[model samples]
Target: MAQVEITINSKNYRIACEDGQESRIASLAAMVDSHVKDLVEQIGQIGDTRLLVMASLLIADELVDLREIEREVSSEGGAAVPGDGEEKIVSALNAMAGRIESIADQLERA
Candidate 1:
């Protein structure tokens, strides 16, 4: 496993991933960080945990929209293959959502 350092809401986290997926992880982290920053600007620095949850929900919403698009395209008999980057994005978003949910669960327990 490769450990990648990522920053979200100005806080740093070290995340482990596949050895060759470091850059991909960084890119995904950047997306999440960007969302978190945008949420902070709009809502103020409410809390790191809340900002993260909001960011995750925002990204998950995007993922849902993408899936709907893909479904429509497929239903329309379009030849566009969604397995290119969209599938990867959907998978990444799902993983992030799981992680966020786990964190939220831990926070609730605490």
Candidate 2:
């Protein structure tokens, strides 16, 4: 296992990942950080937990869009079929959303 320190909304978090997945995890974290920052810009710093939940929803929306596109392409029998990367992205986004929601639930209970 490997630990990666990621910064989102000026706060740092230590995340553990498989040894070879450190870079992939870092990349995902960067994407998440960008979303959080963009959300902050649009809505101001409402709250970290709210910002994170909103960001997760926004990313999940993108995943939903991608899945819709994939479905349309498949229905049309288009040559430009979505690849494994899209599947991986959808999977990652789903997992991330689940984790974020879980954290939010825990925060609310505390």
Candidate 3:
């Protein structure tokens, strides 16, 4: 285990994590600090305990939303990202429309 020093809301914290994972820990801490800083700016120096609790809740909410999306995508056989395969559909439709136009042109010429 290695200890990483992280600063959140101007306060320093020493956290332990797997060896060589210090960067990951610091990155995650920065995200939490950003949330805490935003909370402080909006709500003003709420007690540390309250700030931590609220931040934790906010992160949890994000995780829940992400999990829900993953579940929905998995249940549909596989993830169907927004606009995935859209280009192919559009290409096929355009080709059909072009063929129809060509037929119409031929009819007019005849």
Candidate 4:
């Protein structure tokens, strides 16, 4: 395992990941940090725990919206897609949402 240092809301967290997945972990950390930063800018500094909860909710809400859109698309027949890469984009979005959910779960336990 390799340890990756991720900064979110200016706080550092050291997490372990597979050696080759350091970059991937960092990218996800960046995503979370971006959400936190946006919230901080819009609402000002609320405690770390509250900020993280809000960020998690924002990410989870996006996930729910994506899932709903995916179901609507599937039910309407995927052949009616708008563009060529829509399917790929949806798949990637869902995968990212799953990862976000996993991260949220880990945070809850922490």
- Estimate every model's Cα lDDT from 0 to 1: 0.75, 0.75, 0.71, 0.78
- Please state the error at residue 3 of candidate 1 in Å: 0.6
Candidate 4 regions exceeding 4 Å error are 79-110
Query: Would you estimate the TM-scores of all the predictions?
Result: 0.70, 0.70, 0.71, 0.71
lDDT of each residue in 1-110, candidate 3, tens digit only: 89999998898999999999999999999999987886676567768887788778667755665565556557866647665345444554565445535633543454
- Per residue, candidate 1 scores C-alpha lDDT tens digits across 1-110 of 79999888778899999899999999999999998876666556778888888788878877776787667667768746646556656675686666656645554564
Model 4, span 1-110: residue lDDT tens: 89999999999999999999999999999998998887676556778998888788878877776777677778878748567347656676777657656755655565
Cα deviation at 14, candidate 2, in Å, is 0.3
- Cα lDDT tens digits for candidate 2, 9-69: 9999999998888889889989999988866665577798988887888788777767775
Q: Candidate 3: lDDT of 66?
A: 57
Clashes of each: 0, 0, 0, 0
Error of 4 at 106 (Å): 26
RMSD values for the candidates in order, in angstroms, are: 8.8, 8.5, 19.6, 8.4
Candidate number of the best lDDT: 4
Pairs clashing within candidate 1: none
